[model samples]
Target chain A: MPGIEDLYREIILDHYRTPRNRGELPPPAVYSEGNNPLCGDDIRIYLDVADGVVRDVKFSGQGCSISQSSTSMMTVAVKGKTVAEVQAFVRRFKHMMTLTNESETVDESVKLGDIEALQGVVKFPVRIKCATLGWNTLLEALTEAIK
Target chain B: MVTTLTEASHNMSFDSAVIRRDFPLLAKQIDGKPLVYLDSANTSQKPNAVIDAMANFMRESYAPINRSAYTLAANATEQYEGARAAVAKFINAKSAREIVFTKNATEALNLIVSSWGRANLKTGDVVLLTHMEHHANIVPWQMLQQERGIELRWVPLTSDFQLDLTSLTSLLSGVKVFSFTSMSNVLGTINPVEKLCAAAHAAGAISIVDACQSVPHSPSDVQSWGADFATFSGHKMCGPSGVGVLWGREELLEAMPPFLGGGNMITDVRLDGFTCAELPAKFEAGTPPIAEVVGLGAAVEYLTNIGMANVRQHEISLSSYVLDLLTNRFGDDITIHGPRNPELRGATFSFAFRGIHPHDISQILDQSNVCVRAGHHCAKPLMKIIGANATTRASFYLYNTTTDADTLADALDSASDIF
Candidate 1:
């Protein structure tokens, strides 16, 4: 059995307590919301994208440590990255969260940084949705920004 | 014999320690920790008697009921009907024929909304509901409103979490049907069913009580409540899943059309049309959950032996212990979203702790084998009213003791430390 320590690492708790880029961006920033109806974990991602790059990003939501921390981490991870880079990073982040036997061989081209702390969330299958709620909302916001 | 046993147990002081021994799951250990199950509001842990009854029935007298004329089939039918009779007696219903078996309480509520709501209600017809109702009671009515253009009105809550009945008269003015939960599944507020039903009747409307949360924990009398329809799930009362009871006034059941059409729900059939079966059978429709019903019978018998009055007494005491422990220890840091009085609520406690998310709290508690439900608890409207996206709910039952309550408090301490 995976212990609680694995799921709630110090890095994760730190990120949850003092989140980075934790405010909403006003319009002309593309915005999207994601929620887990089961646990009532809601996430909203705001993105300011220009010239195929995410110029700025912020997140505002209320959820468990995994979700809120992931959202906070997500804003920092994608803030200065191009749309393509952020999209690829989202795929890799989600890949880490997936329950695949081949998860050990995740593409290491992009550094996951603090987001890798959420890799432990996959052990608790139910919290996987929590750890990914931010990224999913980010993807939605990215789609809206590009369009 | 059952009445004598129930009365005898009621006089004696309720002993949860002795009662805990009856449920095999309470003895279970996870990760070197004894399981402190406090999610009975979700689904109860079945006693050994229910488990054995179901297993023994399947092993000894397993046969399809009501179809074959064979001796085995006859005996199976007897046991199946016997379960229905037990459920009727448990709830103090007028007759077993008034109890219609369904998949679960959701299906039971759906049966009422789709069958009775459709036949009785028209466009612009009003169905008054309470704010604390489970989604089962709310969503079906909403569906009816969408399809038939019926109006849905809600009875809001007071500042202290109890139902605000001050405007119930005006709310029921134009209501053709008034449906509400006998107890709030989230807040643990026990509604005045008899009073609500009387108010509904005074306004010339029928009452449907979602007794899912109340029936298992307390004494239920459909006749006394003066309700037209009442529904509850067996699994929430130490019974197995896949079986639920919908007790209705016989006349109304007789008048309404069958919800499902298949074997066992009809008497005579033709290519053109079919005649529906009488009372309960008309609504049962399919080959019922025979073994689960038998298990439910055992569960009803177990509760009857212990007496629901005693069960309610145990919960009251436990609720008081939990309330004092959580509030006194946490102080302003913890916010329990229910009536402070034990008499006003069940042992179910939906609380917010130190700004910690309910999911995180429950997750940390799970490390200590303290099982609790964390979410909207299928009462989203009440969640919104309480100003929480979700709340951590720890619900107790007849088998739980004050020690379990203490364990929960200690676990909350650890959760705060982690967060």
Candidate 2:
């Protein structure tokens, strides 16, 4: 059985206590919001994209430590990456959290950085939605930006 | 021999050990620790009596009811109808024909909305509901408002979370239907049913009570409440799932159109139209939950033996103990989201502890084998009104003891140490 410590690691707690890139972006920023109404976890993703690359990204939400800290880590990871790179990162991060395939192993190619700490969220089926709310909202913002 | 209510009420004392023994799940352990269940408001743990009643019925006389005329089918039909009579007597309805068995309390409430609201309500008519109603009560009316262009009025809450009836008259003005919960599933505040019903009558509106939370934990008399319709589920009352009771006035049930049309609900089916059946059968559209109804009947008998007044007294004492313990121990660190008076509320306590998320608190409590519910509790509007995303709810029933409260407090202390 996975313990609570596994779900709330020290690094995750640090990110939650002092979140990074938490605020609004200027005009022409790509923005989208997502919320898990069941848990009352809400996330608004704001991104500044220039030249097919994320110039800046920020997230603000009120939720459990898992959701807020994961958003903080996600913002740090995808800030300067290209839109394609961020999309790939989102896919890999979601794969790591879901691990839905039987024959699929963890792909070592995708360097997850601080977001890897959230892999333990797979153990908690309910909180997986909380941890992924920010990433899902970011993808939506990216799509809106492209449109 | 069945104990009379007077005899049962005379001995108002509760024996938690004896009551706890009735439920076998209470004796189980989780993670090597004894189970400390405090989530009765969500759904109750079934006693052996209910389980055996269902199992024995299924084994001996389980057959399709209301269709076949064989001896076995007759026995099953008798058992099923007997359950309805038991429910009618349980809530003191005028006749058993007023009680219609549905899938669950949600379905029961939906039956009222779809049958009565669709038939009687037209565009621009107003329906009054309380802010503290569970989604079951709120969503059905909202569905009607969207489809039929009806207006919805809300009875707001006082600062302390009770219904603010200061604007009761204005809110009830021109309302065609007044529907509300008898108790708040999230706040545990018991509404003044009699007064609310009288107000609805005074405003010339039909009164409906969502007695889901109240019916199980305390005595429920739709006649005494003077509500035209009331609903509750068997699963919440120490019975099996897939069975619920909808008790409506005979005249209203006779007048309303059928909510669902199928095998058992119609009197005659033609190419163009259909004539509906009588009161209870008109609402019961299909093959009903026969075994579950037997279990519900046994649950009613069990609660009658225990006496609802005694159950309420037991809960009052338990709530007082819990309030004193949690407050005196944690002080301002804990914020219980209900009226402080035990008499004003049921034993449900939705609280925020030391700024910890309710999910985190529930997870920590789970480690100590302390079961609680964490989330919006299907009452998102109430959660939003209370200004919280979610809350950790710990509710009690007759089987709970002061020891369970102590276990919960200790578990909370453990949670705080980590958070």
Candidate 3:
């Protein structure tokens, strides 16, 4: 079992303490809301897209550490990526999070970035929802952008 | 059976080392620290009494309750009825016929709304609920609302987390069925059911009390409260899982259609139609949680031997001690939700330390072997009402102590620093 040290490394806490892209985007954006009804986690993801690119992204909500930190990390991951690339990353992130060792592999080159820290989540099944809340919002917002 | 309020309070105490021995888990250490479990409002730990009661039934007299025309069958049926009777006595229900076993309190709540609400509630009727309800109480009615087009009305909670009775009066007029928690599992608010039931009746609404949190800790008399129905779980009171009690008025149970119909729930079956089994049997379909019901019966007996008045007083005193400990140690670093007074609350208190997410606090507390609940706690609307994503909660039972509270306080201080 990977220890909490792997998940709560200084990098993860830094993103949580000083979140990047922590504000609202302007109008003409696809907006989506994802709430973990069981745990009281609510986050609103807003995306600024023009011509198949995510120009900017922002989110705001109240939740526990794994959720809010996950959201903060998600905002940083997708901010500068193209719309299609972000969607693929969402699928890859979800697959990696499910931690199916036989069926999934993450690109250690991209480093899994801030998300690599969340590997400790797989050991705690109840907390898997906490780690995925923000990622689900990313999917929701992207779907809205595609439509 | 009801004691005066003062007497009940006076007889309860915070010094209960003997009670701690009853719970085997309380003595152990977690992560090299003594286990300070305060999540009873979620689900309580089982004592030997409940465990032995279940093991005893499985070993001495374990048989299916359905008809088999044998000695074992008769014994099994008797034990099942005995459990129903025990449940009725525990909650002061009018008859054992009124007790229906469910999978959990959530399923019990669903049965009432789906079965009773469908037959009685019509379009444009309002189902009044509080914002602080567990999703079990909210979502089932929302399903009904979608079908029947019933208005989903909220009895807004006050800023401090108490039910806004002033707002409730206006919403109660159109309400056909009123469902609410006797005590919030998360907020620990103790609502006055007798008075609330009175108002709901005056407004011509049937009251359904979600006693999931209250019944396990306090002595309850559903008959005196004049509630049409009340729901609670066995797991929360140290009984085994897959067993919950839905105590409704006898007439209401008889009148409502069978929630789920299968072999055991049917009296007569034909190609054309089926005659449903009477009263309690009609609602409980398929095989029931036999061993669990027996365990719940033992739980009632155990609580009775300890005295419910004593149990409730112990919880309040422990809650107050923790409240004071948090105030003295953390002070402004801690922001507490719900009423400051333990009297106004159940055993649970939702709070947050500034700059520390609940997951962080809970994880840190876990390092100290302190078991608490973190997250929305199945009370999101309440969470939104309180203005937080999540909060750390420590709920107690009769077995908890002030020493446990002190440890929790110390853990919070460390957690605040850890975050």
- RMSD for each of the candidates: 2.4, 2.4, 2.9
Give the per-residue lDDT digits (tens) of candidate 1, residues B1-419. Answer: 01235554655956899989999989999877899999999999999999999999999999999899999999999999999999999888899999999999999999999999999999999999988999999999999989999999999999999999998899999899999998889999989899999999999999999999999998888998999999999999999999998999999998888898998889999999999888778887778999999999999999988888888877887898898898899999999999998888988999999999999999999998999999999988889989999999999999998899999999999997887
lDDT of each: 0.90, 0.90, 0.83
Alpha carbon deviation, residue A66, candidate 3 (Å): 3.6
Compared with the true structure, the alpha-carbon lDDT of candidate 3 equals 0.83
The clash count for each model shown is 0, 0, 4
Model 2, position A44, has a per-residue lDDT of 93
Put down candidate 3 lDDT per residue, A1-147, tens digits, no spaces: 335565566766777777767777667887788888666667888898888888889988767667778788888888778876786677677776883366555444344676877777777676788789888888888888888
Question: What TM-score does each model's chain B reach against the true chain B?
Answer: 0.97, 0.97, 0.96
Q: Is candidate 1 or candidate 2 better by DockQ?
A: 1
Q: Candidate 1 lDDT, tens digit per residue, A1-147? A: 689999999989998999999888999998999999998878888899999999999888789999988888888888889998998888889888874356454556988998888888988999998988888889998899999
TM-score of 3: 0.91
Ranking of predictions according to DockQ: 1, 2, 3
